[model samples]
Target: MKSSTAQYVMGIDFGSTTSKTVILDRAGNMVASAIAHKGSVSNDGAMVSMAEALQQAGITEADIARAVSTGYGRRMLDIADKSYTEITCHARGAVHLVPDARLVIDIGGQDSKVIAVDANGLVSQFAMNDRCAAGTGKFLEALARAVQVPLEEMGPMAMTAVEHLSISNMCATFAETEVVALLAEGKRKHDVLGAVHAAIASRTLGLIARVGKREPVVMTGGVAKNVAAVHHLEQVLGMKLRIPPDPQIAGALGAALFALDEITSPDHADEEDRVDTEMAAARCGTPTCTAKKPLPANVHPLHGPALH
Candidate 1:
């Protein structure tokens, strides 16, 4: 605890569809961050993303005093000092990006989540759709392919849509078929794209219903880059959304923030020694306490964000 204030910390979010890394100084300012959309995840991919982030920050691994990992493949990073759920990390990152944010909607590659953050800028209730790929980024990618449009071009194409084509299904596979059918029926590509956005927005509304709504909603994940998704979701929810400039890296940012908290805590030195001792004594050939501690009993298991 003797002035770890100048230390730099790292956060690695090894998600299902992408790997993102963020570095921050103890003051919680982002030093550098990088997101790599690599569908197949490995330690090497995480390392590459972290290396890129370090390169951007003009720093190296030696500079990072602590690190945390989050997202679907969080445990793959053996170097992480800690690991937290994406629910907690996403909430932390969203609140950091938009402090007034009450509801956070994240449409990640394989799933979508709706998180409710309370007045204190911490998570309250949360809901997610992990079983199905519908209403997620992958769903959009499938539809884009069906329409013969590059995935990156679909959003802008949707913007030019003058008419909406109601898609019959929200299921990802069925929706792809619908997109193809719409095209065969001589429908406009832009209009089909617009309908896809609305279909996703409508499905997101169902998630929002379960979590309930709060004003000043913000969105994160790669899907936030889609103007039509944001626009259609806003139209459906009737509230303007707050989107961070780097929405996709919010989870990594939150993990970096957690690292900052961990490295500078009053018990930092003691905890470090405790973890080392636990590993040595057990001789399990593992970092016994690193990234393995559960949330304290006083905090809600699913909603705690560990803010500074």
Candidate 2:
């Protein structure tokens, strides 16, 4: 890959609620990564993340040899040389982070997906819940509001539950109503939050079943940082999960790897053609279907200082 004169490559994930960027050196090592929360599929968010990543890597945009993009707004980035679906990028990125991972469970802001990967980091099968926000971060955000708790505090409060409570097993909108009803019944906020997290675990398990469960499962995306969600998932799966230090950037990292491949791999053109067709088929062909839904007020997917 270093045979090319290019010194670095870049990958951007234009997610609905957040944008992520990753920069890699010629040696295929990640040099910098950044995440920005700016409304749904906002171009400003993408630019912010890319600028932060480049600044952290101490490189100019001119220094990057190639760039690839993935996620909801993948095609919206004019700077991207190529684009891939989240399924492909997430599978590739997860395997790169956890080489022994045979299963990947990615619960992002808008969707939840389970991918079955082979030893070579190739996706064997995958399943996603994109129809609604039933098992996603947005769902938790809605429940948090209904329970009158901060989004960031829901996880810890849920861990303190002493009773098992149940929320409506419907869409996020309906679930919020159920949460309100539970609170009206004098249920503790902690127990109600517990039910909310457990519900996500149950929905995620259904996705896992579709792709067939495998060992050494890896969890990625914003939800992996949620302690209660992870705990509930582990209890339900009867196994522990491997979480990367920075789980949100897995898709962007995968995009960076593909950018590297574009410079290094001999059959890159043919691979690009194949992925283009797949991306088209995966699209819902409707603006509203792909548009970013409004996130809860005062909610930010990223926590603390940006990772360099």
Candidate 3:
């Protein structure tokens, strides 16, 4: 790897179902970003996303001065200079996307979070639903399959609903059963889809209540792309949500910003030491240390472990 005091940095969000990477120049301009789907929090997904972002930016891994990571598999990235919780990163990312955003609602594949952020992009309070799959993209996927409707089309079809139906249970399994029962009772697919989105919106409102509602709310994560989800959330909140141009990359963008901060600000320069300490605490002594394992041969790391 050639290194002449790197001029770029990278941030990665290793989500449960998808991974995102963003590259930024020294000035914090986003040079490139990429997302890749995975069955779970697989390292391959992270590698693919990072590789793609690097390719797009026309830079080698060595060009990055620092790398920060977040999301489910954050610590798994051997190249990461630091790692932060999803809440911190999402709050930072959302606020960056919408400067006045006071509340951030992120509904990812397997979890949902509502964050109350300060003007300085710090999380004041946050509520998350990680215990169950309810009101998440996974829940929507299961219900979509049960309804024999394509996941992408469910949003548009739901918009045509003529009635308001209900799915009482919050459990994905139970929700699927209830959906089937609703269909058995001759409920139209459109109305059923509407109920599904409404259920998610209701659950989201519960989270928002925990953090207390704030103005200029921003919705991030993969679910933000769903029209029905956004519409229903707006309906329940009775306000329009500020969604970023690329909603799914918010965490990644936030991570990138943090990486940039670590380099530019003397206050954050010690983040790398904290990250190293945390990684040491989590690392296994086994020869195949998952935490420090290298990425696949095709992918290059920005720093740290040598890619095979």
| Clash totals for all candidate models | 0, 0, 0
Model 2: clashing residue pairs?
Answer: none
lDDT of 2 by residue, 99-199 (tens): 99999999988899999999887999999996889989889877877887998899999999999887765589988888888889998999999999999
Best by lDDT: 3
> Best TM-score goes to which candidate?
3
lDDT score for residue 25 of model 2 = 89
Query: Between 1 and 2, whose lDDT is larger?
Result: 2
lDDT of each prediction vs. the true structure? 0.83, 0.86, 0.87
Decoy 2 TM-score against native: 0.86
TM-score-best of 2 and 3: 3
Residues 1-308, candidate 3, lDDT per residue (tens digit)?
43327999899999999999999999989999999996699899999999999999999998988888999998888778678888889988888889989999999988999999887768999999968889998999899899999988999999899998999646888999999999999999999999999899999999999999998899999889999999999999999998999999999999999888877883565555556545654665656554545457675543343312
For every candidate structure, what is the RMSD over all alpha carbons to the true structure, in angstroms? Answer: 6.9, 9.3, 4.5
lDDT of 2: 0.86
Give the candidates in order of lDDT, highest first. Answer: 3, 2, 1
Using TM-score as the measure, name the better of candidate 1 and candidate 2: 2
Pull out the clashing pairs in model 3: none
Candidate 3 local lDDT, residue 139: 94
